[model samples]
Target chain A: MMMEKLTVYADRMSQPSRAVLLFCRLNAIDFEEIKVDISKRQHLSSEFREVNPLQKVPAIVHGNFNLSESHAIIVYLNSAFPGIAEHWRAKINSAMDWHHSNLRQGTVSYVINTVLGPATGRPLNPNAAAEAEKVLISSLSNLEDIWLNGDGRFLLGGSQPSIADLSMVCELMQLEVLDEKDRSRILSPYKKVLQWIEDTRAATNPHFEEVHNILYRAKKKFEQQRSRVAETGTEPSNKIGGHSKM
Target chain B: MMMEKLTVYADRMSQPSRAVLLFCRLNAIDFEEIKVDISKRQHLSSEFREVNPLQKVPAIVHGNFNLSESHAIIVYLNSAFPGIAEHWRAKINSAMDWHHSNLRQGTVSYVINTVLGPATGRPLNPNAAAEAEKVLISSLSNLEDIWLNGDGRFLLGGSQPSIADLSMVCELMQLEVLDEKDRSRILSPYKKVLQWIEDTRAATNPHFEEVHNILYRAKKKFEQQRSRVAETGTEPSNKIGGHSKM
Candidate 1:
């Protein structure tokens, strides 16, 4: 069977894009990965909008058809590939649905308001990060108690990691940039969740680390800036992270 | 064939619960409809948490298995019943994913803060709503220009309605609680969207109208109160919407 050609527009900086990119690489799916450079605001350009009128990252163009939203793109891929386990179909669907407004919201929005917004040149919104902490704790507790309590090593108790796990673990992994005290305050309470993250990472291996390299670099730069500010008497300029247009 | 019994925990006031309940009622799915009244804060109670720890409505119990999230529950039903149309599987899934932080967020939060909060005596956050309108406008424009552009009456250009139709239209119908001028200002610009709502309502028929009766009455009482205030020139002291604890 001839597999349909797919062109993926993605950025490593975003959580969902990392999940979609890692999935393709882990499965050895043939495709072109075009870096959208969200920090550069490439997603707002007219050409990208032609492919995805919503102008969001992690969109895919297949033949004449175009689809946006990372979860949607992954679901489309599941059918196109025909190799995903039958048992995973319904459970994975449910997980993605739950992930959308829960883990995705709790993790991504929390970090964006707290660390990313301030670290980047964008103005940080007050109290959102504080509110987000409550949501994150509640969400991670559910992930540990409800989703992971099943017999399998991954969510839905499956022996292998589903796309849902990849999607969620990627969202949680963004906390790596935050200083240890803050990161642990949020993540350390959930015992099963930490184990699940490691298991998911080991399962995805080289591709997992490969896709996350850019994020790791971003964290290092953030740390260096914090240290530099400590050495200097003056505050870091407002334009410190101007590249993060998103 | 013998069928397993199912139980659905829901609240009529919440948009997604209406979607899930209507799907069951329309398809003749055998299930117990348990109304966890949000006004009473029944969903937050410990008993309900045993069913769905996250404490949100539109959860379900099938034997010992439990699941929350309206989108997840409906998708699970599509497979468990196997009576849903084949064409709906992919498109409906995609629509639900796109809906989470987009249409659902834009419509529900905007109304909650702008209209429902004030009417209900809940503290309304100004910026959250001001921000939500921007998102709502962007989402509606896409629904008009892209999703509704198809030949079919509903999203995905389908001849008959899908669960996605049930979910999204339920969200837009919440605007019925707002006054005519406000509602018209937000809704009137999108001709196709207005038509799509009517088409969806017609397709779903009596059940759609029947399910939305609570919202209808809420709107009527709101109008009556406004009229009373006009005649007497005093604010209504009674909190009419106290039951809508959400």
Candidate 2:
């Protein structure tokens, strides 16, 4: 009998997509990956809409079960692959689960809404990037405090990594890739966070080395795209001065 | 054995705080609520800051386990009380946990950035409000599509309510309390969402009704506070204006 296949629809640059990829790798789950070209508006296409109407990446199609949202996918996968040589269930404990759903969500939003938008030329205002930096810094300070006070190992109290680690590490990695300034700011003051990154990378599967490589390449692509936009002197779609009424 | 005293530190008008209150009511979790006065800037007070340096509401103290962030609180309560005689876990699974996180977060940001500031007599750039509205409308559309496609009972697959329902409902309620016009435009088109609200209210524990009443009272108080700010004609906090950056 053929192994049950998990088909992940993802864009390598999306932090959530990378989280899913890392989850599959860590669990030794057999899956095929199909890249969704977010840059080309592939997610907006009708064919992709059938799979996930939200047009978001990090969706998984497992036979009849179609799923989106990286958190749900990670939880479902952990539950499905209970015997995959990892203490999967323990990772979804009270604190870590909450962290994944709340603090992580807050930080990621701050990064995306503030940092990524401005860096990519889709900011609501020119000053939006600086505002995001302030919020991001404040949130990072809170995270650092949590690490100092909490178990201080993996995001949860574990010798091994879990979903919480996967969720957070991916977001942090995405922030790092946004620009050298962001990377330096995040890594400089948060020394423990830097160590956490090393730990998570070491824990992740070697297959995901390809996924990591893809992020670096995507960052380069994003820079090139930004420069092209600058050269053409054309504003991006979501900018405040563009079609935005506000 | 003393029943575990879960003390909630909250400001009822806040969306996240309401989520925690609703969850406790839905699950019959015994807890005490300590209202933090947002009107007097109590959240920013050093006393409150010790509990949560981020100074956000929806923080909880259950014995030695203190936590902030509404989503985290719900997940923690659900897990901590697994025998609560409900399909809570399944509710989290089907409620578009991942999608709801993004949608609810975005909606709250929009409401805070656009409506709340203006309602409180803080000068809002009309252009900024309009831009925030556009993003908010897009998120609401996605939510409407999800409801149109899903089980149509609760947010998840259950005939009963879940954490997702609480989170989304609180956000909608926040928008409603902030700007009646904006709420009508955003919520009126989705019939199923309206039905979901009715269903959730009917299914929730009577204790939650009390909490809802408290929130209503708090909303009125918040409105008064806004009126006072307008009357005084003082400049709003920079943090309040910083939301648009997100």
TM-score of chain A of each: 0.92, 0.77
Output the worst ten-in-a-row residue range by lDDT, candidate 2 chain A: A88-97
Model 1 bad stretches (over 4 Å) = A233-246, B118-121, B227-246
**Tens-digit lDDT string for candidate 2 (A1-246):** 125678999998787898889888776788899999886778999989888877889888887677887877777776676565554442243334455445565556556664455645564343554555665666566666664345746764567776767777777777655656656855689877778878778777474566778767757855675677879975444433335544
Q: Which ten residues in a row have the lowest lDDT in candidate 2 chain B?
A: B237-246
Measured over all alpha carbons after superposition, the RMSD of each candidate to the real structure, in angstroms, is 3.5, 5.9
Poorest 10 consecutive residues by lDDT, candidate 1 chain B:
B237-246
Model 2 C-alpha lDDT per residue in residues B10-90, reported as the tens digit of each score:
987776788788777666678888889886689999988877665778788877776766766766676687666555552
Separate DockQ for every predicted complex: 0.57, 0.24
| lDDT by residue for model 1 (A1-246), tens | 236688999988999899999988877778899999876789999999898877888888877778888887887777787566544665577778888877887787788887788765767765888777787888898899888988988997989998889999999989988766788888888889999999999999999999989878878877777788888854445455455344
Best by TM-score: 1
**Quality of candidate 1 docking, DockQ:** 0.57
